[model samples]
Target: MQPLTKLLHFGYQQALSSLFPVIIFLTLAGTKAIQVPGLPRYDLILLVCVMAQIIMVKTGLETKDELKVITLFHIFGLVLELYKVHMGSWAYPDFAYSKIAGVPLYSGFMYASVASYMVQAWRRLDLMIVRWPHAYWTIPLGALIYINFFSHHFVYDIRWVLTGALFVIFLRTMVYFTVDHERFKMPLTLSFFLIGFFIWIAENISTLLDGYRYPNQGDTWELVHIGKISSWFLLVVVSFIIVAQLKRVKGEGFANQPVPHAKDRNM
Candidate 1:
């Protein structure tokens, strides 16, 4: 197939794959087959994920680096999610519909795929913010996003939150060292990965500790416990070392150096 056709095909597959989870949840809701906790109506998370993917596919503005960054983020997210489930940080109400391993296939796989699109949207918007740097809008926008998590329909996972926070710190350190030593300038890809890592940790931690778990319904707190938290930390440190080495090898010849008033087409 031609390159353009191939990209279109990939986009279609990604869109359908990402939307599958939302479709399943809606169908389940209609038939009353499964009822998720902390969720009153249909699966809004699934809807948001699907919508984000659709918007990106329609825009046709994605670059190879953006795709690479998003793909890696989702891969890392899935790995962390599998760990969360194994640790019993959270439990699914319906075992029958569980997809991959223990996770609903849609939730485990499709939802993650959808997250890539969401990250891309955030990147595009982030660029605009970087350009405009409006304190008035940024603070309010950040608060709005944070507040939305408290709503009844939105369940925060505590274990993920803690893990995510550590990840963000790790990424921030990576960025600071890279820029400080003139090894490599921070790019959106690196920033997004750091943001995603932190988010994943934060969301899981929030839900596991303070957020709600449903169906089996109990008032007792699960308490924060992650045997693998140290493992994740080690991984982040190792990843930073590797990325730093790679950056050094590429040196100043690497084309992604930061430029003012200019967007990185590679991204």
Candidate 2:
């Protein structure tokens, strides 16, 4: 009972940090029905997102270290964006002065939003993982997964092999999160799938909000393919590997502050 309650609170914190951008995008998407502004919708949203990021830091909602993680995602996401857009993957369907290579600047923020949730949830929920693989293995696998995203177009896709590798590497790993004085545990690989599934759902919503257009969607709204789950699953793993670089172990003399009675959830 206690663990469930804490998990809910942790989720609430995560939703606040991550979903704010989606909420804003959805709300402003309605403005297309009636507009009085000379600025394009994409530019306006980009401006608001930039301000929102600054405000989060100024208000102390995000720590400097966390901001660094989020910024890293932005840069990495932009690089992926340039490659994906060039390769005729999903695309932005609107006009924006902020456009480059047919990708709007705001597109990168979509990935940063995920990073914000990861860092915020790590702090808010006091997260840790057990039996985490050594960096030697995780880092190389992450690099390969990231590269496959670009190379799949020219070379044959190896995501199937990578998916199997995740299972092998994380087979014994469990993620732990503290909800108040208690802890709960779940398999790390499962969490990867869950996060990926949710991100895929958000992708559908984003496209409906005019975030981007996929090859088959044509100018009309359509549900994003369920098959994309596999892609997002691997992508989420990449995100996790980057975030794990922080080494945010919560207890056993790792964190700066003591987390009282907050041990691994298996108990």
Candidate 3:
């Protein structure tokens, strides 16, 4: 394929893979703008997200295994949300019957959307990792990255330390994906950063729609701190590691796929 056509095809696939997340963002904006007489915005968002998930499954857009992975992320995200909200890092200011401890149940979908994107992109792009590190290296790193999110508030902040460790661990890793009939490769760490950056952008959009509010936004809405890219970057690392491990356990052997040659034109 020509370079331009290939790029466009890649973009199309990416957008398709992000369909679920796109729906969530639209729901947030839509609910905020057009409130129901009796329904809370958060509750409405929860309803829409649940309906969207059901549709995705019934329509075969999401596989059963993918649903399982997405559910895991939902749990992880909700736990973090509960802790962060309690710690006053951020809050769900709106009232809803579906809320638990001040967080709307819909909040978990935010994290689930990230996993949804990963699994969809993996299948759509035929993603494979080259030179992936062993589980021992990746699992512990992922655990610490997640732990540091909560622990940093009470104890010493070890985010920078974990970030440095991530670089070293994934230095040799490369993500290979196909666009159109051509194959391309990029550093795995770079992919994590790119995904994180885009999520940061989405975070800004979500906050603007009152999806959730950071303490700074209580009075007025402003751009989320650029430094949040680091947190999102680390979160993306944890998400990627979990997805990779799940894929590995399902018998997609990590670091086993041979790199495709330039002459190969089929996906």
Candidate 4:
């Protein structure tokens, strides 16, 4: 395949594979719209999500290790979702027997879907990193970012400071991914911004579909505020920090080998 065509194919696969959970949610919603009688919408969504995860694993779309990552995000995100719904960050905004503390059990899959995409992309794209920091630095920052998502309700929001810290730490880091025979390099920070931007777009779509509602959304649909990109960007940071560990980098490289140079794209 030509390089451009390969790039497009890579992107299509990444978007589709990573978004399996979202697809299932939207599908269950459609089923609910058609007045499926078997289960409530939220419960139906939860069931479909679980089935989707199982299917993905069985089909080898997600590996055991990747499944572990998805499980981690589900737990982490569910706890945060419970808190955010309580604090009115956003809401499930629908009736469901599966609701706990006003947040649906299905909600965490939305977050796990992000990790799903990360691990899938990592494996499919043959991803590698340049100038990655040690685990000690990233782990604590990831923890703080996750913590601030909750603590900011009472304490100060250090997200901005943490954003600066991300740049400081990953400033020199670059991610190398393959499309066809060409190897491409992107700044780690830029990749985070791009992913966050797309997630923001997904957020808007999710809200428009009534997957959830924001404060500004109600009687009519409203575009998700661009400012939410900052929030998503930080969450992306946390997600990336967690998934990057799976690569087991031995240096500024991948698979324990040194990264290739820009001019050396024959890989």
Candidate 5:
């Protein structure tokens, strides 16, 4: 493909992969500004999320296995939300029947959307890993990254430590993705940071729409701290490791898979 054609194809695939998240963002913006008679904003958003999931599956936009992974992300994200809210890391001050421990159920879908993007992009771009660290390295690292999210509240924050470790672990790793007939590659760690940065941008948009509030935003909305990008970066790593490792176990890792055929290429 020519340079311009390749860029267009890549952009189209990215937009397609992000369809679910775009819907969620639109729902957030819409619900915040428009209200129904009795339904809470959070409750309305939750309903839309549920309906969107069903519609995606029914329309074959998401596979059953992909939905299962996204659901796992929801559960994991909700647990993190519960703990973070209790710790005063953030607050959901809005009223809603769906609120549990001050968190609206729809919050989990934010995290699930990340997994959804990963799965969709993986399939659409035919992503593959090169020099992925062994399970022994990745599993423990993923666990520590997740644990540190909660443990940092009680102990010294070792996020920078873990961040450094991420560099060392993935230093040689590359992600190969197809843009068209040609293939392209990026440092896997760079992809992690990029995804995290974009999610941080989305987080700002979500907060601006009253999706949730940080402690600093209690009085008025301001831009989310740039430091939150580090958090999202680590979270992205954990999400990627889970999805990538599962693919490996299912015998779909890059080694066993053939280069995608032309007819099979969606981009």
Candidate 6:
């Protein structure tokens, strides 16, 4: 099948899967036994899933290596998030629903899928930097956008900090290894550092916009602030470097292609 066709198919399949949780939620919501107040309705989950699926399909599925990395990160995040909930590091103000293994399956799946889409988008856009001058700015800009909109909840639910920290560490270590091994060497680590710095700024802005006053509350900064910035920078830089290296390799390979003999070519 054509790549575009495959993308469409994958997207529809994912979109359907995303709605599964909503269906389950609706069934349970009808029951008086399940009390879920002020819970962002399952409709939100459906919307998230639909949007994420569209993004993923548009971007293309993540490469196998990227998928592996994402899976591990998701697993690690899930574990930490579960631990935080258990330890009272954070509490869901709305619904009280625990699924398999004492974690909400729908929430876990949604988060993981979103993370996967992020990785996929990054990979698909990997070559853009080469095509456009100063395209690297998008890395930081996108991070800033996401942090501004999405990070306030982190402050409200500090348990995410533990999971977020773990994710940062995992990403950092992965990027470090990629850089050290010269797998995909980026020439502009400085750009990534800037992006990370901007992410921190965005997060701070998000907090203020949310009317949150945090004076080192829950020690979130103490644990993950610096590390998160560092990791974001490293990940972006390494991703760029890898793309750069891959392009170079591809160019070299094409250049080294053997000339066809006239007789052989005709044959």
Model 2 TM? 0.89
Q: For candidate 5, lDDT tens digit of each residue in 1-267?
A: 577998999899999999989999999988887899899999999999999999999999999999999999999999999999999999999899999999999999999999999999999988878788889999999999999999998999999999999899989887778887677777889999999999999999999998999999988899999999999999999999999998998866464333444433222
Ranked by TM-score, top first: 3, 5, 4, 2, 1, 6
Q: Candidate 5: list runs displaced more than 4 Å.
A: 256-267
lDDT of 3 by residue, 148-186 (tens): 999999899999999899899988888878887667888
lDDT of 6 by residue, 149-201 (tens): 23444555232443343334333221211111122212233345654575455
Residue 29's lDDT within candidate 3 is 85
TM-score, every prediction: 0.36, 0.89, 0.96, 0.90, 0.95, 0.34
Distance from true position, residue 251, model 3, in Å? 1.9
Give the 10-residue window scoring lowest on summed lDDT in candidate 1.
Answer: 174-183
**What lDDT tens digits, residue by residue, belong to model 2 across residues 1-267?**
865787687767667657545545664576556554798888877787888878888888878878888889989999999889888898877788999988888778888888888777777766766677787889999999999999899899999999999899989887777666577678889889998998898888877766788998886789999999999999889998888866544232133333345555453
Query: Distance from true position, residue 66, model 6, in Å?
Result: 6.0
Query: Which digits, one per residue and each the tens of the lDDT, describe model 1 over residues 183-246?
Result: 2234433554553465445435434432224223346645334543443343333333323333
Residue 177 Cα positional deviation in candidate 3, in Å, after optimal superposition: 0.1
lDDT of 3: 0.91
Top TM-score: which candidate number? Answer: 3
lDDT of 1 at 8: 67
- Model 6 stretches astray by more than 4 angstroms: 1-43, 58-72, 96-118, 125-267
**Clash pairs of candidate 5?**
none
**Candidate 1 stretches greater than 4 Å from native:** 1-44, 60-65, 87-89, 94-98, 106-267
Scanning candidate 2 in windows of ten residues, the lowest lDDT window is 250-259
Stretches > 4 Å off in candidate 3: 261-267
Clashing pairs in 2: none
Clash pairs detected, candidate 4: none
